[model samples]
Target: MRIPLSDDNGHQYRDLNGNGVLDPYEDTRLSPEERTEDLLGRLSLAEKAGLMFQTVIEVGPDGDLVETAGRISKSPTSEVVTGKHLNHFNVHQIATARQAATWNNNLQELAETTPHGIPVTISTDPRHAFVDNAGVAFSAGPFSQWPEGLGLAALDDLDAVRRFADVARQEYVAVGIRAALHPQIDLATEPRWGRQAQTMGHDADRVSEFTAAYLEGFQGASLSSTSVACTTKHFPGGGPQKDGEDAHFPYGREQVYPGGMFDYHLKPFREAIARGTAAMMPYYGMPIDLTVGGEKIEEVGFGFSRQIVTGLLREELGYDGVVVTDWELVNDNHVGEQVLPARAWGVESLTPSQRLAKIIDAGCDQFGGEECTDLLVDLVENGEVSEARLDESVRRLLLVKFRLGLFDDPFVDVDAAERIVGRADFRRQGFEAQAESTTVLVNREATLPLASSIRVYSENVRPEQVSEWAQPVATPEQADVAVVRLLAPFEPRDDLFLEAWFHQGSLDFPPGLVHRLSRIAEHCPLVVVVTLDRPAILTPLVPFVSALVADYGSSDAAVLAALRGRIAPRGRLPIEIPRSMDAVRASRADVPGDTENPLFPVHFGLTI
Candidate 1:
């Protein structure tokens, strides 16, 4: 086979756009047959092996998540970047301009190697605004600033979503990112469920609507020179947990549908498929309690399930794109779909190696958030995995990479990226989104739009911080409005949550604090904005505030915009905010979000 080993000396690659040079404007759309032949012909066995993995990235000097973040480990990112062959990388965070440059330079060098040289498919979690989680790790980095998904959802404008996705794509492509790891489209059915705001809203219908629109925005209307591919996530619907907790934690891993009454949950995935999403990610918690043919199936995410991915998505939905398992969960390496546990058992049972094998065999084409392609190569060499399997995945991956036009123009125009990303127009759009998304919840006293002369006090916000709006105040008596920013409680844990039962509970926040704030709100017209990861019980504060906004993911811009009326508030609540803790506890824990005793129904929002 004619192999393309080095960047400059490979004939296996042919320039597609008929351009004499490999420039940013090259077009890579191929007829299905032509695309297959090109991708196959360009990759040698070794190179194809390299394309199977979509690995995790390390941050900082300390490679461990437990220690300091923002550094790459000496092992793979250092090693993989050196050998110059990788399919995908999910950056932890680009800490410095130097780090960003180095990472880009590595991918750039790799792209410069082959005939139809493919650009590295880099991706990231949310990086625009506040509450950076499994996506970007560091607070300070070379990032394009914007609002979170909820903030974007609040904007409820197709133009704004398009702008946000465009900027994100520009920022990513500039730094060699071709794939976007999110637009987590799961419906936030349960309010107290962690990661609720990450979605567009609670209704499957709304979530479906927003996700379809977002997929278009993020990926662009088509896979052209400038558009980045959107990876729509948590297939077959991920929300409706037993306790509104994430499945990443053990206590929240069980997915309950309540006798399959909500059988239409997969409505969004069907839409995503119809909309031509570039990729799919199975969530950690979503597992069908029943089994096909009478075997108890247990796995964290749906991507790892054949019943979910192969049977439903590929066979029924006719989706011919890539399917990758959620990070940290798919560790078992499989032998003809027979999954085995992992190698790194640090008080844990499985290592990533074993898990990797199983997931590949189980029909997962790519490994999301993995850092080591070498591991897959090793397995292939050791006779544990097959070359055909690797080839299968590589072909699918390369197809998308080709579709992304990475094969032609891999290098990012940093200047263009800067110009397009985080532009004043986009930021203004985010502000508008926040305002529209923010629902007042209550306006009995009509205390909203407090005069510029009114004072405010908050737990997280200082008196001086509100000085721009009004004078500093010492007590609730002195303030005309008491604005509070509350944080969602959490204890970051592993994706599977294979820990003790007690430790596997939903995030805990301070008790009776909302009530205390309510007392202050009762006296004065107050606006409470919950800066949280999950839904908070708000019955206590209902009587106190004239306006309320669940500032999803601590989007300060969204919060500010809503209050300032830069954009009209229109975002319906993504989850039903409960009335009390007892109500939540009394609801079915077996089927967390599937329960109907919500303090507030889905899309419950009040406006001034």
Candidate 2:
């Protein structure tokens, strides 16, 4: 079919009386082919650039931002979210079906207010499980729950990942969640990272495969049907941080690639791009400190790196999709905050107009963490930015909307969201994943799956939870097997840190708890399951127990399913579990942020 001529395709220049030179904003009556250009020509420069930025979930307001260099300075001012024009709208904290519904309505309110009525595509961080991060808000919400990424990793089943994504889309669609902001395919190369729970399991090939499958489900073949837009994130992969710390903060932004993990880090991304991912969300970290561009910046990860985004992702990988910034505008402590461009705040050196220009030139289609419209509107009237550019972005954004079938089916099924948003099937899926995700790392004497009647003793251990797998007992003398779940211990970096990551910081484990558990392990074959979100250094118990398991229990049901052997344990450790803490500390910290560590390279999953 010959495509009709349109302004977007340069067909609108066909006017016999038209000037040879293209106008910045065409005001002519455009044919169907010339409509895009004509519309774009009508926009002033400022309106063109504003389409590229977004407001965080709660930051949809306007305030008196001191205009320095034509930019708003967010030094500290009261702002009210009055604009409807936002590239992305993040609604964090998925509380309940009702809450999600309400949030959806609020987002629609903003969408309806856009200049062209550009619907605010409400996106969410993972909301299926207990991620334990309250500040990010979407960790545990009203959506139907699923096993976290680790659980999916354990199953090592791409089909399972796809099914899970389909289910998640259902829940999201139910509550008006049009876009999903995850599938962090970054390989887990650093074991100490407390945040690997959200990633697909630990192998480049495996992660890539599952990531593709997950995307397949999220972006179905037909946009006119059950499809949800998804953003494959932390582009180029964001796993190899210094201490497994996220690149969200200054401490975690330096991507050291001393081990040369950069090349390997790109596999999953390659796969994701091949699978037709609609959107890409770059992380806050940049490879400035590494050889990515053979340079070092004091801070700022790849999110703003024009080299990485335009030169690499666009030119190298051939990804012609929309690029959205991470949540930088939100003052939230969990996600990156200092991430918003200095332009968005109207800084003195680089005006807001300049910031918007740089972000667009850098290949960012939308500015996340923001919802400002006046700034862009004002700039357009002044002819600082071109309206044609805004039209370009609008075209891209509209394409995604078209792909998601939002133009035809925008509203979520209020009834379905109520019916199946948190249905039993989803819960069962979580349990199933849990069982498959868990791994029995050590079982020297074949002491696990203890006899029905066996004595067990352990402090802070739930003997009853495992009673079905083996016998529960008061004394260590009579138990046939002892299952002790070890809680990894660590000291918080500061008061605020503990308050944000953990529910209670002051609570201390009873002393000699390991010693007592060791006695139980010695009495019978000991099976130690470490219920940790992050790796809790388990070397101390290596010699004491016969078996060890790392559940990283974001989903207890998945853990339980893994224990039952209903699902295969395919989740290889995303990051290397050091034999000792000293090993990790001695290793080079300057690994590339994009690739995997050869130390425990990607796809090292072992099957039992």
Estimate the TM-score for candidate 1: 0.81
Separately for all candidates shown, the number of backbone clashes (residues 3 or more apart, or on different chains) is 43, 66
* Highest lDDT against the true fold, candidate: 1
- Estimate the lDDT of model 1: 0.60
Per-residue accuracy of model 1 over 226-267 as CA lDDT, tens digit each: 767877777767776776665655446677665453445677
Q: What is the C-alpha local distance difference test score of candidate 2? A: 0.58
Q: Rate the local accuracy (lDDT) of all candidates.
A: 0.60, 0.58
lDDT of 2 by residue, 225-265 (tens): 46777788878777667765555444555566667777787
